[model samples]
Target chain A: MSSANSDTPTRILESTLALLEAPGGKLPTMSDIAKAAGVSRQAVYLHYPSRTDVLIAATRYQDQMLDMDTALAPSRTAANGRERLDAFVTAWCNHVPKIHGVARAIMALTSTDAEAKAAWDIRMTDLREGCAAAVAALARDGTLPDSMDQAKATDLLWALLSIRNWENLTQTCGWEQSRYAMTIRAMAVATLTQDTGPLTDALACPEPPA
Target chain B: MSSANSDTPTRILESTLALLEAPGGKLPTMSDIAKAAGVSRQAVYLHYPSRTDVLIAATRYQDQMLDMDTALAPSRTAANGRERLDAFVTAWCNHVPKIHGVARAIMALTSTDAEAKAAWDIRMTDLREGCAAAVAALARDGTLPDSMDQAKATDLLWALLSIRNWENLTQTCGWEQSRYAMTIRAMAVATLTQDTGPLTDALACPEPPA
Candidate 1:
C-alpha cells in the first residue's frame, strides 16, 4: 500500500477514538465516524467490513498508541511468579484509567448493541489470556495454593482486575490512582497466592500473642 | 386512605419490574408501565411523579418480594466480625443472581439515562452502607489490619461484591453459584481479616520447612 493509502485506516481509527471519548457518551455510527475521518462511508466499510470490526480495530489501535506492550513488559519478563503477579496488577490498574473512556463507552453499549458486545467480548477474551498467563506462572513456581487450580485462579484474578472495580475504587470511593493500584496489587497477592511478600504481609492483621 | 387507593402504588411498582425484566431489554416508559398495570397514565403519575421514582420504588419492591431482610438477618445478627463478614458475603453473592436481571437493566441505562443513573446510585449507596457496616464490625473486633483503614477496607469489599463481578464469574467464567459464593467468602475472610480460621487457612499455601 502507498503511504497515502496506509494513512486512511489510521485516520479512521483516530476519529473513532475521538468520537468515543466525546462528552455525550453517544455511540458513533459508521457514517458519523467516516465523516469525522474525512472519508466516505463506503471507504470506512471497505476497510472494516462491519461496525464491530472497526470498533474492535479502533480499540486495538488505541492500545497500540498507548504502548500497552511496553507497559506489560515488566510483568511479562518478571523474574518470579510473585513479581509477575505484582507487575501485572500494577500495569493493569494503571492502564484502566487510561483506557477508561473508551472502555466505558463500549461497556455501556454491551447490553443493547450486539456490535458493541462483540467488541467488548473480544477485548475481555484477550485480557483473560493475560490473567491466565500470570496464574500459570504462579503454578509453575508452586506459589499458587493447591486448592485453587489454574483456571479458577485466572478467573479470580480477572474478576479482581475488572475495569468496573477500578471505576468503583477511584471514582465512587474517591481513592487516589496510586492508592488504588497499590491496594489492588496487595489484595491480589494476598488472595491469589501463598507469597508472604511485603505487600501481602502488610495486608494481614496481626495475630494476638499466641 | 382506602385499601383500594393504597393498592395502586403496589400495582405500579410490580408492573414496572415486569416491564424491566421483559425480553429485548428496552426501558419501559411510564405509559408502557401504566398499560401493563391496567391503570391510566395519570394513576401511575399519581403514585410516582417521575420514571426515576417508580424505578427506585420497583427495585425496593422487588427486594421486599424476595425477602431481602430475611436474607440479611444472619449477617445482621452474627456474633462477631468474622461471622458477620462470612454471612454478608454469602447473602450478597446469592442475592446477585436473583436480582441480576433488573440490576443489569438499570446498569445498562446508567450511562445514557439520568433517571436510571439516579436509581442505580441509590442502590449502590445502600450497598456501600452494608459494606461499611461489615468493615466497622471488623474494626470493632480488632481484626482489621493495621495498615488498612476501615474506609479503605470497606471500599475494597464493596468493589468485590459488585454485580458486574458476579456476572463475570457465574456467567463468563461459568462458575457454579455455590463455587462463586464459597470462593468469594473465603477470599473476603482471607484478605480482609487476620483470621486464621478454616476458610483462610485453606487458602494459604503450605510454608516451606523452616
Candidate 2:
C-alpha cells in the first residue's frame, strides 16, 4: 500500500480503537472520531461512512497484528514439534498485549452482535488450527511418540492457552511476558512428553530433560 | 446473622447479580431489581446503597463458589501429592462456567471503575497465594520434587488457570466442561512430575502418547 493510504487507515484505526477502548463507544459519533483523529468530518466518511465500517476495518487491523498464525510461524524452527508449539505459545504471550481491549470486547459484545463474535471467532479458530497443525507436524515428523492422539493434544493445547490464565499471570502475578512465555512453552513441552505420573507435581518440578 | 439483616443482603445480592447478567442488566435501575425480586427499594439500599456496592458483594459471592482451592479440594484424594493436584484441576474446570461472566467482567470493565478492579485484584491475589500453598504442600510432603519453588510454581499455576483460556476452550472450542476439566487435571498432574518427557511431547506434538 502507498504510504499516504497506509497512514490513512492506520490513523483511522488508531482513533477508532481508542474510542472503543473508552467507556461506551456505542454512543460516540463519527464527528467525535474525526475530531479525535484530527481529520476532516468529510474525510472520515470518505473511508468509512458509518461507525460499523470504521470498527470493521479497525478489527481487521487488530487481527493482522495479534493473529496467532503469524506469531507461531517464526518460532516453528525449534527442533521438535513440541518446541515449535512452545514457540507458538511464546508468540501469543508476545502478541496479546498489542491488541488492547480486543479480546474483552469480543467476549462481551459478541453476545448481542454476531458480527463482533464472527471477527473474534475467525481469529481464534485460525489460532487453534495453527496450534493443532503445529502439534501434528511434530507427530508426523516422528518428533513425538506415536501413541498420543492429535485431538487430545489439540484440546490440551487450547486448555493451556486459557484467557483467564494468561491475563491473570501477567496482570495479577506480575511476571515479565518473557517469563510468562517461558512458563507455557515449558508446560507444553512437559504435557506432550511426560509419561504417566503425578501430573501437577511433575509440572511444578524443576525443569529437567526427559 | 439475623434473618431481617443478612437475609436481605442475600436477596439484594442475588437480585443484583441476576439484573447484571441479562439483556436487561446493562443499565438497570434499583427500581427494576426491586420489582424483579418483589423487594422494597429500601431493602437494596439497606444492604447496598448503590449499584457499585451490590456489584462488589455479588462478585465476591461468585468467587467463593468457584474459588479453585475449595472446588478442587474434594477431588484431591489421599493420592500422591501430584495426583491430588491433578484432581484439583479437574474439579476446577467443573467450577468455572458457573462464574464465567463475572470473570469476563473483571478483565474488561467498560469504565475505569477502581473499586471493582481493587476488589477483583484482592480475590486474584488470594487465588495466587492459595496455589502457591498447594504447590508448597506437595513439596513438603515429598510428593513433588524438592526443587519446586513456591513463587514460580504459583506463577505457572496462574498461567494454567487463565480465564480467557477457559472461555476460549469451553465457549470457542466446544468442549464439555467435564472433558475440559479432565484434560487439565491430567495435564496438571503431569506438568511438574518426574515423567515429564511424555507431557512435554503432549504439549508439542499433535499426536497421542506412546
Candidate 3:
C-alpha cells in the first residue's frame, strides 16, 4: 500500500477524536469528519464503510495513542489475586479520566443509536473480561469469598467499576480523582475478599480533625 | 380559578410522560406534546414556560401515578438502619423498571441538552437524599463503619443504586429482577455495615447442585 493510503486512516481517526472531544457534545456527521480530516467523502467511505465502524476505530486509535496496554501491565503481571485487584482498580480508575471525552461521546449516542450501542457493548464486554480475569486470580488464590462463585463475583466487580459509577462519584459527588481511585479500590477489596482483615483495613478512611 | 384552567397543567404533564415513554425514544417537541394533549402550543407555554419545566413536571407526575411516596414508606419508617438499608434498596429497585422508559428518555437528552441535564440532576439529587437518609439511619444506630463518614457512605450507596447500574444488570447481564434486588441489597449491607455477619449472608448466592 502507498504511504499516503496508510496515513489517511490515521488522519481520519485523529480527526474523529478531535471532533468528539470538542465542546458541546454534538455528534458529528461523516461528511463533517471527512472535511475536518481534509479527505473527500469517498475516501472516508473507502476507509470505513459506515460511521459506526470509524467511530469504534477512532476509540481504538485513542487507546493506542494513550498506551492503554502499558497502563494495565501491572494488573496483568500481578504476583497474586489481591495485588491484581489493587493494580486493576488503580489502572482502570486512572484510565477513566484519560478516556472520558471519547467515552462520553459514545455513551451519549448509545440510547438512540444502535451502532453506538454496539460499539459501547464491545468495549464493556472487553472490560467485563478484565473483571473476570481479576476474579479468576482471586479464586486461584482461594481469597474469593465462598458465598459467591467466580461468575457472580465477576458481575459484582464489573458493576462496581462501571464508568457511570466513576462519573457519578467524580463529576456528581465532586470526589478528587485520587480519592475516587482509593475509595473504589478499598470498596472492591471490602466487597469481594474473604478476609476480614483487608475489609477493615480497606474501609478505614482517616477522620478530619476538629 | 376555573376547573378548565386548573386542569391544563395536569393534562400537559400526562401528555409529556406519554410522549416520553412512547416507542422510538425520540424527544417530543412542544408542538407535538401540545398536539397530543389537544391543546394549543400557547397552552403548553402557559402551563410551563419552557420544555424543561414541563419535562421535569412530567417525571414528578409519573412518581405520583406510581404512588412513589407510598412505596418509600417502608424505608422512611424502618425500625433501624439495617432495615432502612434493605427497605430502601427494595423500594428503589422495584421502582426502576416502572420508570425506565421516561428515565431513558431524559438520560438520552442530558448530554446535548442543558435543560435535560438540570432535570436529571434534580431527580438524582432527590435520590441522593434518600441515600443520605439511609446512611444517617445507619450512623444513628452506630452500625455504620468507622472508616467512612456519613457523606462518604451516602455517596457509595447512591452510586450503587444508579439507574444505569440497574440497566446494566437487568438489560445487559440478564439478571432477574428478584435476583438484582436481592444481590444489590446484600451488596449494600456488605459494603457499608460494621457487622460482618450480614456480609457473608448477603454475599451468599445459593449454589446450584452439581
Candidate 4:
C-alpha cells in the first residue's frame, strides 16, 4: 500500500477516538467518523471494513492513549498467583474510571447495535483471557481450591471485576476508589482460591487486618 | 367520592403497567398512560401529581402483581441472621428473572428519564432497608464480623445482590439460577460474618461440599 493509504487507516482510528472522547459524545457512526477525519466515507470503509472493526480499533487506540500495557504490567509480571490476582484487580479497577465514558457509550449502544456488541465482545474476551491466566497461575501453585472448576473460577473473577459491578459500588454505593480496589482484591481472593499455607504474604495491599 | 373517581388511580396504574410490559415498550409518558387508560390527560394529572409518582406507583403495582409480601415472607421469617441473608438472596435472585423484562425497561429509561430513576431509587431504598435489617440481625446475634462496620457491610451485601451483578452471572457467565443463588449466599456469608463455626447450618440449600 502507498504511504497515503496507510495514513488513511491511522487517521480514521484517530478520528474515531476523538469522537468517542468528545464531551457528552454518542457512539459515532461511520459517516460521523469519516466526516471527522476529513476523508470520504469510502475512505473510512476501505480502511475499516465494518463499523465494529473501527470501534474495536478505536478502543485499542484509547488503550494506547492511556498506555494500557504499562498499567497492566504489574499484574502481568506479578511473582505469584495471589500477587497476580491483586495486581490484576487493582489495575482493572483503576482502569475503569479512566475509560468509563467510552465504555458506557459502547455499552449503551450494544443493546441495539450489533457492531457495538461485537466490539464489546472482543474487549471482554481479552479481559477474560487475563482472568483465565490468573486462575491458571493459582492452579499451578496448587492454591486454586481443588473444589473449584477452573472455568467457573475464571467466571467468578471476571464477574467480580466487571465494570458494571465496579460502577455500581463506586457510583451508587459511594465507595472510594481505593476502598473499592482493596475490597475487591480481598473478595476476589476469598472467592477464587484456597488457603495455600501463608498466602497472606502474597496478598499485597492487605487492608489492615480486616 | 364517586366510584369513578375512586377507580381512576387504579385504572391509571394498570395502564402504566401495561405500557411497560408491552414488548419493545418505551417508558410511557403521562399522555401515553392517559391514552392507554382511556382517560383524559386531566384525569391522569388528577390521579398522579407527577409522572414520577405514576411510574413509582406502577413499580409498586408490579410488586403487588408478584405478591412481593409472600415472596419475601421466607426472608422475613428466617430464624436467624445467616438464614435471613440466605432467604433474601434466594428471593431476590429468583425475583430478577420474573421481573427482568420490566426491570430492564425501567433501567434503560433511567439514563434519559428522571421519573424512571426516581422509581428505581424508591425500589432500591426498599432493598437497602432489607439489607440493613439483615446486618442488624447479624450484629445483634454477635456474628457480624468485628472488622466490618454495619453500614459498610450493608453496602457490600446490597452490591452483591444488585440486578446488574445477577444479570452478568446468569446471562453473560451462563450460571444456572440455582447455582447463582447458592454461590451468592455462600459468598455473602463469607464476606460479612465473623464465624467459621456452625454457619453452614444456617446456609440454606448449601451446595454439598463443593
Candidate 5:
C-alpha cells in the first residue's frame, strides 16, 4: 500500500479488483481499503458509501471499457473488410481478462436496475452498429462473398464478442488470454468471409483428452 | 407470496435470484426467501442450509441439462454434416434459454469450489469431445472444407453458446427466444458452410449515435 498511493481512487479500484477475486482471501473492508490507500474510510466514502457502492463502482470500473465507442476507431474503416472485422474482434477479446466476473453482475443488473440497463444499452447499440459496419465494409469490397446478410453478420460479430464464452474458455478450459484472442480474430475473419480454416477445425484436439 | 406455490424450492430459488440482484441482498435469510416463496423458513432450510448450498442447488438445476451427453450422440456420426452440426447447435441454444441466469452463476464459481468446478469441468470436457466427433463426422461428409481446424471449430461453437450475449438479445434488445434460437442455428450452419445469403449485409444499417 505504501509503495503506490499516488491515486487514491485507482488504489481503491485495484484493491477492489483484488477483493472481488479474493485470490488471497475475502474482500477488504472500507476501513481496510482506506488504510491501504492511506486515506480514511470517510475519504473512501467521498468516492463510495457502502460495500454495494464499492461493488458497483468496481462494476462501473470494469464496464467503462465496454462503453468506449471509440476503441480501435482507426480500423473501423480499414481497406480490407475482413481486417476491420478482425480488428474489432481482437480489440473486444483483449478486454476479457479485465471484465471477467463483471459480465455476470451485468446480467443480474439487466433484470434488476434501470441505470444498469441504460449503460448496457448504450454499449450494445454501439457494438451492433460497429459490427454491422465492419462486416458490411467487407461485403462491399467483395472480401466476403457478396451474398451474405449484413444484419445477421453483425449478430455473428456480437456472438464473437461474448464475454460469457470467453470466461468459459479461460475458466473452464484454462486457455490463456493469447489463445482466446487468437481464436476470436480467427473466427471473426472466417465468419465474415470465406475462411473455413477457423470454422471447421479450430476446436478439435489431436491429442487424447486428459 | 401467493402467486405461485407449486414447489417450495423453486419458489425459494426465484426469490433468491431476485434477492441476489438487489442491493445489500446477502445470501438471503431463510425467512426472507420463505416469505417471498410463501413458505416457512424451515421449509427453505430443508432444501438448503447455507447460501453456498442454495447456489449449488441453483447451479445444479441449470447444469443438469449440460451434464447430459445424450443430444450430442447423434452428431458423432451423422451422414449429413450440416444436419449434424445443426442438431448440436439446436440442442445447445434450446438448453440455454431455460436455464437463463443459472449458467451465469455456474460460470462465476471458481476452480477451488470442488463441486462447482467438477461439474463445470465435466460439462466442458464432454462438450469438447462432442464437438470433436461432430467436426470429424462433418469432415467425412464433405460438408466442411478439408483444412478446417477441429479445436478452433469447437471454440466457434462455444462462442455461439455465450450466455451473457444471449441474455443481451432477450433482455436488452427485446428479441424473442425463437428469433435468437434461429440466430444460433443460422450462425452455426452459415459459418460452418460459409453460406452468406442475407447475413453478409451485416453492415447495411448506419451507426446509431453513441
Candidate 6:
C-alpha cells in the first residue's frame, strides 16, 4: 500500500482517540470521525466497514500507541508469582489514569450501544486474562489460600482492581493515585493470598529483578 | 392538597422509574415523562420546577417505594460491630440487583447530565453514611486494625460494596447473587478489619438477634 493509504488508518484512529479524550466528550459518529481525520467519508467506509470495526480498531491502536506490551513487561517477566502480582498491579494502576478518558467513554456508551459494548468487552477480556495469569501463578506457587477457590480468587482480584473502584477512590474520595495503587495491592494480598505477612509489608516497593 | 394534585407527582415519579428501567433506556426528557404520566407537559412543569428537580424527586420516590429504611433496619439494629458490618453487606447487596436498572441509568446519565449526577450523588452520600457507621462500630469494639485508618476503612468498604463491583462479580464473573453477597462481606472483613477468621466463616449466615 502507498504511504498515504497506510497513514489513512492511523489518522482515523488518532482522531477517534482525540474525540474520546476530549473534555465532556460523547461518542463520535462516523461522519464526525471522517471529518476529524480530514479524509473523505468514503475513505473511512473503505477502510473500516462499520463503526464497531472502527471502535475496536481505535482501541487496539491506542493500546499500541501506549506501548502496552513494554508497560506490562515487568509483570509478564517477573521471576516469582508474588513479584508478578505486584508488578501487574504497578503496571495496571499506572496505566488506568492515562487511558481513563477513553476507557470511561467506552464504558459509558456500553449501555445503549452494542458496538461500544463489544469494543469494551474485547478490551476487558484481555485484562481478565492478565488477572487470571496472576491468580494462576499464585495457585501454582501455593500462595493462594487453601480457603479460597482459585476461580473465586481471580474474580475477586479482577473486581477489586476495576477502574470503577479506582475512580471512586481517587476521584470521589480524593485519594492520591500512588496511595490508591499501594492500597489496592495490599488489599489484594490480604484478601486473596495465604501469605501471613503484615498487610503494610505488602505495600513495600517492589525491587526490579536483576 | 387535593387527591388529583398529590397523585400528579406520584404519576410523574412512577413514569420516571418505568422509563429509566426500560431496556436500552435513556433518561426521559420532560415531555417524554409527561406523556408517560398521561399529564399535560404543563402539569410536569408545575410539579417539578426543572428536570433535575424531577430526577432528584424520582430517586427519592424510588427509595420510598422500595422502603430503603426498612431494608436497612437490620444493619441499623445489629447487636454488635461485626454483626452490623455483616448486616450492611447483606442489605446493600440484596438491594443492588433490585434497583440496578435505574441505578445504571442514573450513572450512565451522570456524564452529560448534571442533574443526573446530583441525583446519583445524593443516593451515594447515603451509602457512604452507612459505610462510616459500620467502620465506626468496628472502631468502637477495637476490631479495626491499627493499620486501617477509620476514614480510609470507610472509603474502602464503600468502594468494595459499590454497585459496579457487584455487577462485575455477578454479571461478568457469573457468580450467584448469594455467593456475591457472601463473598463481599468476607472480603470486606478481611481487608478492613483486624479479624483473622477464615473468609468462609464470615459467610456463615448471620443470625438475627432474637
Which prediction has the highest TM-score against the true structure?
3
**TM-score of chain B, candidates 1 onward in order:** 0.78, 0.71, 0.82, 0.72, 0.63, 0.83
TM-score of chain B of 4: 0.72
Give the whole-model CA lDDT for all candidates, comma-separated: 0.81, 0.62, 0.84, 0.76, 0.62, 0.81
Error of 3 at B29 (Å): 7.2
lDDT of 6 by residue, B1-210 (tens): 112455788888888888877866776789998988888889999999987677778777878779978988999899888899989988999999878877877887787778788879888998999999999999999888776777888888999999999889888888888888877888788776776555545534322221
Candidate 6's docking class is acceptable
Q: Can you write out model 1's per-residue Cα lDDT over A1-210, one digit (the tens) per residue?
A: 122455898888888888887767576889998998889999999899987677778888888889988999999999989899889889999999888878987887787678888879888998899899999999999988767778888988999999999999888888788787877887788777765445436464322221
lDDT of 4 by residue, A106-127 (tens): 7766755678878888788888
- Tell me the lDDT of candidate 4: 0.76
For each candidate, how many residue pairs have backbone atoms clashing (under 3 Å)?
0, 54, 0, 0, 28, 0
Considering TM-score, where higher is better, how would the candidates rank from best to worst? 3, 6, 1, 4, 2, 5
Native contacts recovered, each model:
0.48, 0.36, 0.59, 0.23, 0.20, 0.45
Q: Residue A54 error for model 3, in Å?
A: 4.6
Model 6 agreement with the true structure over A17-38: per-residue lDDT tens digits: 7888787677788998898888
Query: Where is model 4 chain A poorest over a 10-residue stretch in terms of lDDT?
Result: A197-206
Q: What is the per-residue lDDT of model 3 for residues A30-146, given as tens digits with 9 covering 90 to 100? A: 998899888898899999988878888889888888997788899999999999999998899999987887898788878767888888998899889989999999999998877
Measured against the true two-chain complex, the DockQ scores of the candidates, in the order shown, are: 0.38, 0.26, 0.51, 0.25, 0.23, 0.41
Q: For candidate 2, what is the lDDT?
A: 0.62
Ten-residue stretch with the least lDDT total in model 2 chain A: A201-210
User: Which structure among the candidates has the greatest DockQ?
Assistant: 3
lDDT of 5 by residue, A1-210 (tens): 232744777777666665555444333667776775677889888877665566567776656636544667756656687677767777777766666555444544544455665665665676678778887788788766443466656765776676667766766566677777775676566556755343545422233221
DockQ-wise, the better of 1 and 6 is 6
Docking class of 2: acceptable
RMSD of each: 6.3, 6.3, 4.8, 6.3, 6.5, 5.3
Model 1, residue A149: what's the lDDT? 78
DockQ-based CAPRI category assigned to the predicted complex of candidate 4: acceptable
